[model samples]
Target: MINFKIRYTLLLFAACISLQACKKAWQDHTAITIEALNKTLIQQINETPDLSTFSTYLVKTGYDKVLASSKSYTVWAPTNTAMQTIDAAILADTAKLRLFVANHISYQEYFTTAPNPSLVIRTLSGKNIIFTPATFEEAKIVKGNVYVKNGVLHTIDQASGTKQNAYEFMMSTGLSTKQRGFIQSLFHTEIDTSKGVKLYTDPITKKTIYQAGTTFPVTKNTYFQRVSDISSEDSLLTYIILSDVAYDAEKAKIGRYYNLSTSATKTDTLTQFAVVKDLVVNHVYTIDNLPDTLTTVSGVKIHLDRSAIIQTQKLSNGIAYVVSSIGYQILQNKIPVIYIQGELPDSVRVPSTLSIRTKKDLNDVKYTDMQSRSITSSPDPLYYYRYKTTVNSAQYKVYWRAVNDIFTTSFNQKVDFSATRYYPKAVETPLATMGYKAVAVSDYSEVYLGLYTPANYGTLYTFLVSATGVVSTAPSALSLDYIKLVPVN
Candidate 1:
């Protein structure tokens, strides 16, 4: 009986030890499971002692629910000390506070070990924030890559300040008031057909008709629609805003080209738009990397003088320079060469009497040229091919290429200019003294016609007239390939 009691006591001791070990294992497993469930981004921010201010603002902005949801996000949480520097005006306004908070969060979970050295992250506020392993914008990351259940969190030393884009900067700055006002004047409202409500179908035309007032009016800017959209944060642009004195000076130079005898108001508006149109370039160029010459979106080349810059603003979207003056020459870059093809004339004296021939030249380059057909009559019929274009008030040097490949004999042609489209009663003076005389047979070279200055800045009519009106059955006719007018100051 004594031996049986000893064995039973030893078994009881072993059983108690196993029970204690099992309880300890169960407690460890429960702790791990609870930690895994509670370590979401919102919870992680709430638990961090230094991130209390950031956590509070997230809840106030209703972004706490967003971080707690399944969608991934990266939060650059500023410490309480960093939050102390925030503007009191931002906290007073709900919309401003929400925007300020949203600026710190982005859509994706970006870790510090990302392959890219830097990334342009689009934040929840719709503005872009630059992110690097060590920093977010100007704010230094104190503790980074804090992984959570939903996203990653990085503690920052300072809050990332919001910046205005190029368009916004121009509107807010007092120096750019003239440019801002001009751009604002281009705003107009148009009916948005996509938002219209369908009423009924027309029985006769079998078309759907929408309610008259169902569609809303959406405001649009002509400069934004037609030119580069500087307001968009997705693109980068370099905008130059001239001071009021410089603006008036630049307007005076470009005003001569847009001179209208009809309306003074229309002339002023055209001059203002032209001045503003060539000021915005597509790429962002800082003063350090700026080239000596930059081309505008309107295809005008402008000389960049660093000394002329009064203020330089580093915006979120791009850079803006307030300049005292812009260097733009009138003739060199503003006026472009005008080209007119012989076969594509606006009107011909007799369409049936002209033949457009396509042939290869001496260089084996294929080209199309217009040739006069057989006209057997007295006072040899003069064939006229008229071309029209708008010219600035500048002298133009005329050039023409008349390839005489079909006929063995050479032919002659002259050019005449007029303000009206219809044939003038008296033929104006010829462009060249010799009238592009005797275009050699089979010679495919451009002949220079002397310079001619237009009387005014408006629509110009160019008439290519046959120099010698020879009525013959043989192919001794005037032939031309193209005409070019190069502007001279």
Candidate 2:
């Protein structure tokens, strides 16, 4: 038994020694692998013959010490030919040299593992670099997947500069209210508290009327801002701009009678949407597979007329093509519909009801604190809501809803819309319903308002009446819910 115990102790001692040796061998192998991979960015650049020129730039800029330190970074080391093309003036200027080198280095490594990828990387210089991925046919990713102690390295044919894109160029120049108001109708009118009332003499009646303030608050559109953002990488876009002279000429031709500088009023004839659509909707072009004819983000078609491409800019992600003029075809039958809410600033209501309701929700009538409108705690006698709106179109239709209530019998009278010459109607209906019904008020199937070409932005007035053929104001009780405007050819 003692002999067997001694043999077992010796066997256990040998096994322990063998285990230590195996552990040491594995540790040595790991150390060798780590040593092989451990190389600083500067050291790697020094070792490569093609990167000799870039290394000199790094040394001149004193960025070598930055890479030697234990900080992670992705270096897009320029090839020898690219470095040779660097301007001598950049090398002479210390600040410019630092900026140029800093632009090439990113904070983290990005390997070419994904297909057709795009990423916005921030460099040491704090400038954003948009890295666009390409296929093998476009440019081979030379010397990729280089793992160093700090980060990774990838070589490319060319590096992009911080140039503004097509949309950015336009925004930097500034946009006009006339240019922006087409998409958002609310911008058409602005409030000026300084001017209370300006008296204007009526030519035919020799009567004086009051005009309210005309200043509007400054605002921006998010849709256009995003479209012009340089960091947007989801899709490439091509923007075409009309020069100042061309824009003014087109504006004059379209708004010859309409005064776009002053406030839009019923008396002024304005070709509202037609000119704006012709200018903005047709100017933009999107690039997909580089087609000859491309559609805009707003769904307007644009022909890639080579003769029309007067100016062109090569942006990092897209192109900016400037055209001399836009081909605008005025389709008389295909005009867009315009809706004006009763709550707009230009609208006025008299003997106003205590409650107001939106077309969105007819059942709920809530109290509102809107400008240029009279408010009451209870429904007032001779209650009428009269609003005058300017239209670019020559024809429009007004739609209103009649709601019934417990006092339905008291509201037995017809809600006449065209009792005044201001609102002409082709179809008229009596307002004697205890329920809800829409009434279309117009003189013709396509009602004609004043035209801007011959007149001023065609001025039109819409009013509510409690009785038929009742001119002037009469003692009455009625509810004026809402009014909607639809354009016609």
Candidate 3:
């Protein structure tokens, strides 16, 4: 059976195709006069009340003169109904309305449809718009494509102040009282950065807001209670989305948002799984317009343990500004290092080789602390697991690919990994062939890398052979993690 969202997807796809044709025609033809097109559009608007905002928006945004000239484009015009919902005064103002209509105008006619998320679109004002279709593509596409005489318009549900896809609704209104109430109800303290995502008993109430194996701290509010609180008794607990696992083959890695959550339609591509599980415990949600209770704002680099963000700025609601004589400036570079472990293990033995999964788990197995995040832990959290050995069947093989090509042939320097030993990580490295080990890696697990990941995350030289492998020569792709646990029988 077709999903309900598919029809919407097809509509968006059709709209895109229409715009794409216009763009191609504009680029291929000579001086396609905008005056003729605008005349037709104005007539159409006269007959259609819904197009009034489109007409008014054109005039207010200073497009009358330009559209009356020679700019061939197609715009996905919003109906009068859509415009009626928007404030007329806001729509009537030239400068103010630009923000609302910014998504409507692309620079050229060629960009008739949304490309894959990576495709770049230059707006009429020369700004760039990225089409992100990670989730709800049909909804997003429907919201995005609107065609007009001179250009196409994509009508988003909300005015995302910062061009982010994560929080469209949240961006529409800044820091709602309900959101604030939610945060305050959990804990008054700022996020414990030492833990990427945190949860625990309320120090005051001891209500067990947090439970074992949660991601970010879940709230007692409406949103969380529905998804997480299966039993009514499960209510009142705050769950967190934790990205705490070491280079989890399934999760991608311990620290990052990219490639973790995806919506792919291909048969083999996985979809609908919670990239972020249990909202409150183990994850750090990216919040914009932090509440007024948060004072003396200072920016610090935050690592997202496990997060699913629309990553867009909602209307900057209720976000007060204070003038301190300092502006944002970029300076020194730093990277986060984690020493993964829990409590010390009592029994210990040395081995010849370590599996890859244990190493990744060790890297991810740290608890949030007071001083800093998982750099290392008490009695050193690093000394829990040791490297044993690679599978005896493991083969050292040369995987080659095209580095460059002059024609159909003739390329220089195919990517190679000869000197590097691809060892299974038992723990985060400073690895020793002999002597004592720092971290005790959990066994029967595995780590895998992507096409790209920041350095110092795991072993740079040796990558573990995982249950899954992509055909990439990048460091992240080769990096793998492994651990051992029981199977359901």
Winning candidate number (lDDT): 1
Least accurate 10 contiguous residues by lDDT in model 1: 28-37
After superposition, the stretches of candidate 2 with alpha carbons farther than 4 Å from their true spots are 1-37, 69-71, 87-96, 115-117, 120-139, 159-162, 167-237, 243-245, 257-307, 328-336, 341-382, 386-489
Superposition TM-score, candidate 1 onto the true structure: 0.78
- Displacement of residue 297 (Cα, Å) in model 3 is 22
lDDT of candidate model 1 versus the reference: 0.80
Error of 1 at 221 (Å): 1.5
The local distance difference test score of each candidate is: 0.80, 0.50, 0.31
lDDT of 3 by residue, 1-489 (tens): 378689889999999999998899545432233433345334444445545657777777766555554565434445555556666676556665775565444455533234554444444533334444321211243333233465544333333222322222322334333332332343222222333434666879865454444435432433333343211221122222222221122233212322222222321111112222212221112254232221111212223211332122311111111111111111110121222221121122212232222222235562221111121111222112222321111112222111111123221111111112433244533332212111112222322111222222122232212111122222111111222111111
Sorting all predicted structures by lDDT, with the top scorer first, yields 1, 2, 3
- The total number of steric clashes, by the backbone 3 Å criterion, in model 1 comes to 0
lDDT of 2 at 199: 75
For model 2, residues 368-454, the per-residue Cα lDDT tens digits are 222212222213233344555554533445454334332323232222222133333334422211222222321112222221221
RMSD of each: 11.5, 13.1, 24.0
Clashes of 2: 14
Residue-by-residue lDDT tens digits, candidate 1, 1-489: 999999999999999999999899545422222243448899988989999999999999999999999988989999999999999999889999998999999998787656278887889988888887678888987777777778888889998767788888989889867888999999999778797899999999997788988887899989988877888999878999899888888878888777776777877887898888888888989899999888999899997799999999887787899998998767747777788888988988753468898888889899998887443322333567888988876788888898776566765667878777765555543332225366688788888887877755678888877654352334345567988888886
